[model samples]
Target: MANYRLVSFKTCPWVQRAAIVLREKKIPFEFQHIEPDNRPDWFRAISPHNKVPVLRIDDRISLFESASIAEYLDETHAPRLHPEDPVERAINRAWIEYMPTFVDLTSGHAYVDSEAEFEKAVAAVPGAFAKLETAIEARKGGPFFNGARYSLVDAAYAPFLQRHLFLERIRKIGQIDRFPRVKAWAVALSERPSTHSFPPAEFEAMYRASVKKRNKWISQFVTEKAAAE
Candidate 1:
């Protein structure tokens, strides 16, 4: 049996982050891909919340949040993903929190047909990116997030950053050129061998399929509502 098993979906940024950390640590495990629309009963059994990135270790199941999982793995595994220093580890944690806040408030809700909402999200990006840019500049030592070493912070943020860059092309939201440090950091991180393991083309196909399905559902809903009226 595989020492670890991860139930996850490729398109979910959270799951992607966990996968990245596992790869970076050179941890061997089994990956079971779950579909967003149709989550399996076994996954729900492992994770009561039915969330992806549920990791099974020696018959112990864990769930609810990717950051925690990454931290857990870092603590357990051979290579440390966070700084040894307590203060630096806290700083790394802060960055992890920061990435998700921006992602949830801005990027996550940004994808819609509304031009106004999209513009609002676009505006928020600069401020969010600015904060990260300053953080990276002030820290100043890394090709990664926290100096020369790759930390849990980088693992936490890499997947979201990758999606941000990918969406720029698919959504036509413009490159992240304004945030030079972040852009550079993302490029370096994406080139890592682990990143290649999470196939981008497959994720994109899944996303497109989701869009089509959602549109069809909406159309049917509207038609049924009109007929009832």
Candidate 2:
């Protein structure tokens, strides 16, 4: 087994991607959560890209980018989180690559600069999810992106799904209402142990305060945040 240390920010969805993979694979790893503004000098020196989700392996090598880290964990560990067949693996990789789009669509409502911008952002999302709903209708099974087996694709989507669920609670955008498969996937991912595992007690409060600080749309549309489910 390799020694693993992950450097991360508390609320980064990207970092959560790697964390989910690590936990799902049952890798014994150390995780350091740093506030963005308070990142350590040593961490900065070692992380060439200066980003969160840097996975330090054996104190000798540091892997930056959440995608790279997740792939490394999946490749090196047992209980593979990806499909075995080459074509299926390629398909899953394509879906995993789409995670960032999910982030942008799901996160815009809370951080857009103006009401019009917020409306535009949220407007683009339903069409995007409609596409996903179509894709997901073809999924063979349930409770995860890959059905019965939890894969890297599920880990990739889980964090953003949680974010959207949070948004649903705050300001009922009904983002997933029209898409039953997408809604069911989101609900299942939200319940996974890895999804709810990280984040400090102050995560929700801090996230809201930060967004409300920067975006009036958040404050106007958001009510008191419910506790994490």
At residue 25, candidate 1 shows an lDDT of 86
| lDDT assessment of candidate 1 | 0.70
Question: lDDT tens string, model 1, 1-229?
Answer: 3388878785677787888888888888877787888987777777867787788886675655787788788888868878888898888888787776867644642344556655666776777777888999999946788877888777777776765665554454553787788888887776666765546556545544444455432212222111110
Q: Which pairs clash in model 2?
A: none
72-132, model 2: which lDDT tens digit per residue? 8888898899999999899889988877776777677777667788788889788778867
Worst 10 residues of 1 by lDDT: 220-229
Local distance difference test, candidate 2? 0.79
Q: Rate the local accuracy (lDDT) of all candidates.
A: 0.70, 0.79
Question: What is the lDDT for 113 in model 1?
Answer: 52
Query: Which whole-number lDDT from 0 to 100 does residue 33 have in model 1?
Result: 83
